[model samples]
Target: MMASARFLIPLGIFIAVAAFLFKGLSLDPKEVPSPLIGKAAPEFSLPLLNDFEAPFANGDMTGEVWLLNVFASWCGPCLDEHPIIVNFARSTAVPVVGFNYKDRPRAAKQWLNRHGDPYTQVVVDLNGRIGLDYGVYGVPETFLIDQQGIIRYKKIGPLTQMDVSQDIIPLIEELSQ
Candidate 1:
């Protein structure tokens, strides 16, 4: 009887492990939940990409819903995401602040010129310190911050039109009210 109990316990544990693994595999990597959601965005002040003498601070955006799009000139995904961001920027009233992460100023500018600058303001995170503060997993990640400065949503990868339509627009409308 004791031997049968031991076998049953091991089988139960194996089943539990398998179930957890299967669930994890079914989860989307792009849907990673951010720890910053509902929390105030990390404070940062960085030089603008086009101008080094000027600074842009987190406190500068206190009265409106905004997007912080982390991108780099060297990042391939940023190239793919740029068009979507540009269209979204043009269609929306919400400000889009490009967070240029760990990139050369000249390269960023050239890239934007070749593509199109959709950002209302482009801040340079030359050292990636500000990106670290924002918990950037990779280039092309975006954060939606509410008017009060709380981070409402974090998209871990490049923004898709579907994401912009189904998630971003709705949240921005809701937050604006």
Candidate 2:
């Protein structure tokens, strides 16, 4: 009986671990849930990236559905997502608001110049305070906010063309109505 019990204990432990591993493998890492979903977006007032004279504020976008893309020139994923963002920006569906996280103004401007500037308004979060307030885990995170300024969804990684076509655009269309 003792020998049988010992074998079963190890077998049970192995099965449990394997179950957990399988569950984790099946989960998508990019589908991380944000607590801010369906909640009002955190308020922020930051200087514009190109024209510092005109400050940008979250309150100004209250009555419109928009996208807030958190990016930085130093983040490689931001580069990967730029063209998708540019295409989205050109669409009449929604305006793309940029949150430039903790990047040098000159480098950010240069990057935008090299790539296309896809933002309707680019706000500089030079110290990352706004990023922290928004619970930013990394750059290239994108938020979809509804007309009432509530965050509807958050995309944790670079925006892929498929993500835009399948998830983001559909959500924006639904929210706009």
Candidate 1's TM-score: 0.86
For model 2, the local distance difference test gives 0.91
Which residue window of length 10 is worst by lDDT in model 1? Answer: 26-35
Give the per-residue lDDT of model 2 (tens digit) for 42-125: 999999998988899988998898999999999999999999999988875588999999999999999999999989889999
Q: For model 2, what is the alpha-carbon lDDT of residue 71? A: 94
The local lDDT score (0 to 100) that residue 8 gets in candidate 1 is: 97
Candidate 1 local lDDT, 70-161, one digit each (tens): 99999999999889999999999889999999998999999999999999999999888889888887788999999899999999888899
lDDT of candidates 1 onward, in order: 0.92, 0.91
Please identify model 2 stretches exceeding 4 Å from their true place. 1-19, 28-31
Q: Residue 124: error of model 1 in Å?
A: 0.4
